[model samples]
Target: MFDLICLGHAALDRVYSIAAFPPEPTKLRATQAMEVGGGMAATAAVAAARLGGRVAFWGRVGDDAAGAAVRDGLVAEGIDVRGLRTCQGAVTSTSAVIVDAAGERMIVTHLGEGLDDDPAGLPWPMLAQARAVLVDVRWPAGSLALLRAARAAGVPGVLDVEMMAGAALAELLDATDHAVFSRPGLAEFAPGLPEPDGLAKARAAGAAVPGVTQGEHGYLWLDPAGRARRQPAFAVRAVDTTGAGDAFHGAYALGVARGLEVADCARQGAGAAALKCTRPGTRAGLPDGAALSAFLAERAAAV
Candidate 1:
């Protein structure tokens, strides 16, 4: 039985570390260039596996070299991807990430046609074995299917809300058990409100635990009983922020599967996200179970 199943968005990333974000639109040298496996559900699955969760990734990639690398990278991390589909005539999702000296990034993405392919053929029985299922906004159809199955199977569903809107976003917010938002995600769906109010709006729609991941500001959530809480972010010198959020989602899924409280889950996720930022590549610095334990312990010692 898997501890978690991640069922949306898979991409291969081409990252270039530059001296600065914009060089006046002129030619500039990259301090480092590398190709890595990325995408919301894909990287989250990697992080969950790294942190000792028995995880699987179910998503689509093109039948190309980049696709092979993306799948192989997940296997290297010990995630089950027997459900990863290869689509013909459809290109894999790809991203070009530019990281500046301050570790912030500008990401330009090309979302291929394959991400929206039908999810009817996915193995629904897998949800019965999972303790939790996590999804991102990239593939709402797949997310819906898996989330429904998760619900029927008595598993918690965690939604990683990004920049999705309209009926799709509304339906997902209602379906998810734990709705975690990117700051922009909350703004996109519940616009013109403060963060707490936006999350309260989402909670009113039936999401049990509505929250937002506020980068350096930490993780914020409205508890099941309508009480607001915050988990302070860990201090770290980031080398790249590209995959930090992905790491957070994956680890938070693990925490939920293990039945941790919402705030404690945020603490666990924050530690994992902080560790991912210490390295250059997307998945290279993701912490394992031992590493995560040590990181949390160190924070306790400091406190």
Candidate 2:
């Protein structure tokens, strides 16, 4: 059985290292540049694989060089990509990311054109073999399909609620078992509400666990019992913030599949994200199982 199945969004990210973002539309020199695979569920799949989860990626790309690179990168990371389809005449998703000296980044993305939105062709039978499934807002139709099926199968469905319209976010919130939102996502979903209140609203909507990932601050969530819980962020010098959130979501999903307690799962996610921030790229920065165990062990020892 697969430990986790990640669906939606896969892209080739072109990263440029610079001193800082310009105040105006002026050209600036990049200190370094590289290309790597990125995307919400895709990166999470890589992270889960690195952390020793038997993972599969289900998404679409184009029949182009960028798409090939994205596919090859995941395959190299040992994630099952049989479900990663390539669409004819479609442009693969691509992003231009500019990271500054402080490791913060600004991204401009082309979400691709001509990619299929129908979920009918997806391998539905595979859900029964998956311990859990993780999906992102980038592909709402597909995510909804998977989330509903996972719900019926009694498999945990983790939703990465990033930036999206309130209506779409609302529909997804009701379908997920674990709804983890980015700061902006929470703000959008429950506008003007405090974090706890926003999460409470999410829980009421249908998710058993409603949580938000606050970079450097930590993870806060309402557990199955409707009690609020928190997991402090692990402190580490950040080399690059890219993919850190992906690492958190991936590790958390893997933890769920392994039947870890909610708090322990949060800790696993925090440690993984912290470790990822210590390195320079996206996938290359994800911690393996051994490294994550050591990091979490050290922290526990210190505590």
Report lDDT (CA) for all predictions. Answer: 0.89, 0.92
What lDDT tens digits, residue by residue, belong to model 1 across residues 1-303?
A: 899999888899999998886746778799999999999999999999988899999999888887898899999998988779888877898999999888899888887764446998787777778999999988888888888778877899999998754467878888889998999889997889999999999998878899999999999999867889999999999989899999999999999999898777899999999999999988888999999999999999999
User: Which residue pairs come into collision in candidate 2?
Assistant: none
lDDT tens digits, residues 169-229, model 2?
7788889999989999999888899999999998888888999999999999997777889
Q: Over all chains combined, what TM-score does candidate 2 have?
A: 0.98
TM-score for model 1?
A: 0.97
Q: What are the per-model C-alpha RMSD values against the true structure?
A: 1.2, 1.0
Clash count, candidate 2 = 0
Looking at model 1, the pairs that clash are none
